[model samples]
Target: MSSNAAKLIPVFAALALGTSAQTAVAADWYTGAEREIPRDDWIVAIDAAATVTSNSSAFGAVTATIAPVNTLLDSGPRVRLQGVAGTYTYPGTVTGQTVRGVQQEGSVLFGYEWIWQQAAVAGYVGFNVRNNELSILDPGNPVVGTGIGGKVAADIYLNPTPDQFYAVNASYSTQFNAYYVRARAGFAVFNGVFIGPEATLLGDDFFNSWRVGGHLTGFALGPMKFSVGAGYAYDRVRKGGYYTSIESRMAF
Candidate 1:
């Protein structure tokens, strides 16, 4: 349990630490002929589907957050920090370009969250930025340094009830690279164990895709909050391919 909370620390830190108006951010390569592929040609992963409200005008992002209203009324503000990394690969074709590329991303999330004052659920807001690394897969080709991008998200949800969120508020990233908007729901099978599925709509460049995944989170572990999620995305362009990721968030 302690290890799980450690995984989510970075995500909580990027909270208010994110941007405004809008910020968007994305991933690896599947196919391409040019060792020098344009940013647009990059395959956007199918993870996020909706736009958010916590972003700034810098990167077409929205970080929307609704005040929390606790059903128990005892619910109060929650704070946290999180950090994470991921790797992805795909196929592409670049004219006059080369097919030598690799990508890596990581970020820190920090912010405050709690049950909405008007709703029974919960939500949070924060800032986040990711360092993207691009490289030449060819041993003989020169490896390009990693590129940089930014991201931010502020959102509110109906916490996790038997049914998905009765209501939700969120933001999305569009400019940086790619992001998504989604609706989430789940159920608790046992003590300190919750599992549910989420549906996501990917951002631009990346083919639009749908995702179904589950998360496991616990809030009773003292001041330490921990959660992890796994999901698969179905692509419109790749009938047999899917996008998958595991994420965790924690509060200290």
Candidate 2:
């Protein structure tokens, strides 16, 4: 991780904590009919997703959020934890041989969220640890060496009308100079189900990729929500390929 990136961690942490304190103070000021109704004392949410591309690259991630104050349905502070793993195949140094490399990452973040009737935004700052293993060094792989570094992330959701919604998720880490961003918009087709188009951009020091796809989102079964997406992907290293992904989330 770069020293400059590591330096930013303290600044972000201070800002996040300051904002949470202000929010708590403001909440206390409300009284009588102006006071917000409490929904739940706490909430825990888990999300898992996996993606596979035609170019012999695959990735999976899981994230969990613990909000002692129930941030999912209300504004509050939360602790976020995430784990990611990926494998990439590339040409080996030896002729007619291919090498598969593995990468893993874990992070913990402190964050606060603000919610409105139709929109919500959240920001997080934290530290991350990453590891990469390869039998042969491959320049085509994005994630390179193992390191501990700073990380930041943001999520936004907007519901403009009863039938339409949009969401964006982005994150950056000093480890291997990696970054990821995804945006999607959906239109309701059923009571609570939506279908939409989605796009993603991600890269690191050595590799970059973009994907354009369609997704089926907001499908609820019992207590979980599920989504599926498929699309075309283009990357500097892999050239071009197709990708498919599935994601599920549950909160309690």
Candidate 3:
């Protein structure tokens, strides 16, 4: 299993499950990208999900995040932090065997935003730490290890008309020997409601894969918004399968 994917499991799980928002302040539904903190606003969010792969592997995960709306040290950049935990189950890592394990992760990020009457744009960079348990099926498995990585992301939101919305979010991150890329876009059906397509490409020296999907986002209540989607996934090492996701976003 890719350790990096474990840290990101919450994102895909939410996309398929369609429950609870991820990220903190500047929430991005796909890949859990976060916008720059909105003016004078703080946000909190929790995300949970479960997934079963074509390999007969099942996974469950949860993530909690928090951020202050204010800039860092009264500067131009916004800061956010996150914590995550999850478990993985593989029915046949070896012949007639089942494997299960748990993982925990933390991340910190900084963002900058630029706004215009017609559009808003933001970018972020951050570091992450992850601890994972090697599969129980392995003898003398490395039970736990600390791994570190960094990510960069950019997002844009556009309002062509008072009631029209269009947006895109994209990011790339690298950890240890693995890297990840995600991009998603949406066009409003009305006011704050939108539907869009998304793509994810991830891999390392040992593994590589891709997922293509489409999602629907709906009207906001207070500061929260939601989305649901389905997709096909192909892994270089594990082959291919179908999957789905759901997500919500809120800022207060």
Query: Which candidate number maximizes TM-score?
Result: 2
State, as a TM-score between 0 and 1, how close model 3 is to the true structure: 0.62
lDDT of 2 at 14: 14
lDDT of 3 at 230: 75
Error of 3 at 249 (Å): 1.7
Point to the candidate with the largest lDDT.
Answer: 2
Ranking by lDDT: 2, 3, 1
lDDT of each: 0.35, 0.71, 0.52
Q: State the number of backbone clashes in model 2.
A: 0
Model 2 spans > 4 angstroms off: 1-42, 92-97, 139-142
Expressed as tens digits, the lDDT of each residue in 197-217 for candidate 1 is 666665434334565665554
The per-residue C-alpha lDDT of model 3 at residue 4 equals 28
lDDT of 2 by residue, 1-252 (tens): 233222212211211100011111124354533443322322666778999999899999998877766445567797899999989886754453687789999999999977666666789999999998886765555566789999999987766665777778899998888899998888878855678889999988877899999988766665566788999999886689999998876554
Off by over 4 Å in 1: 1-84, 94-101, 104-152, 159-171, 206-208, 215-231, 236-238, 242-245
Model 3 Cα lDDT, one tens digit per residue, 157-200: 55454333455555555654446565666665664456778787
Error of 3 at 111 (Å): 2.6
Query: 1 or 2, which is superior by TM-score?
Result: 2
Model 3 regions lying over 4 Å from their true place: 1-75, 89-98, 137-144, 158-174, 220-223
The TM-scores of all predictions, comma-separated, are 0.45, 0.80, 0.62
